[model samples]
Target: MEKTAFYTVKQIPPEETYPVRHPVLRTGLPLATCEFDGDDAPTTFHIGVYIEGKLAGVVTILENAHSRFDEERQFQLRGMAVLEEFQKQGLGQVLVREAEKEVERRGGYFMWMNARKVAVRFYEKLGYIIDGDEFIIETVGPHYVMCKKWK
Candidate 1:
């Protein structure tokens, strides 16, 4: 049961880049805080998943293109998570395919997120789709605005 590798911040290490403050990755956000903004092109990126070494799993990607749709430019996969005894062992689909291969290697095509309606069937089985409807993220509760496309 050893298969989970993906690091960026200098190949990770410094206590596994411990800055985890994820409350369901801040669910939908409103009252929660801790959103870094800077890196012009880097909307957001932070994935950590160490098995034998610990750290379990963590995520934080927010590549906003106007937060949600504004005509071309999007990638807001907020704070995914997996630490409840490393649930199911899949490691949240390897931290979302390494954050969709770093959002398609930075070219950015499309990859949104805001699913919290009970995880929305685990992001539609890792293919994400649902869009619009079901809102109320003010206090970070119900949500839905999933999207996917890496081509």
Candidate 2:
């Protein structure tokens, strides 16, 4: 299959993102474990990248506040994951850029996430900076709170 033939990224329903989010971000856990807080909020949005009509990557953005940010508009990015077969193909970056655009359009001043330690470099390459000390999320592993500000 031509890599470009069937690739696209767009906003998707929160439920539609579960398949990719579960396997990648919460492997071996119950499907319910993949559900995130604020996923159904009016201010929350989900983005997905599809290849060959299947969900290949997913991300969730919540219009929430972080005490660390004094900005009036803050978004918490959560459940960002891409299938192993699709990594390094730029799908993750595409999803993140699209999400950032949405955030900017909605007047968001900052975006933050508890990013996995393994993915810190990836976020850094996208202009996100480590905001705090490394921490753990129970069954999950090491993570760092990373943030990016638009203004």
Best by lDDT: 2
Model 1: lDDT equals 0.64
Q: List TM-scores for all candidates, in order.
A: 0.29, 0.94
lDDT by residue for model 2 (1-151), tens: 1245658777888998888888898788999988887899999999988887888998899999889878888999998999999988998998888889899989876899989999999999999999889999899999999999876
- Pick out the ten consecutive residues of candidate 1 with the lowest summed lDDT: 7-16
Off by over 4 Å in 2: 1-6
lDDT of 1 by residue, 21-90 (tens): 3444453444335344432233456767776666767666666764456637677776666666667877
Q: Which window of 10 residues has the lowest lDDT sum in candidate 2?
A: 1-10
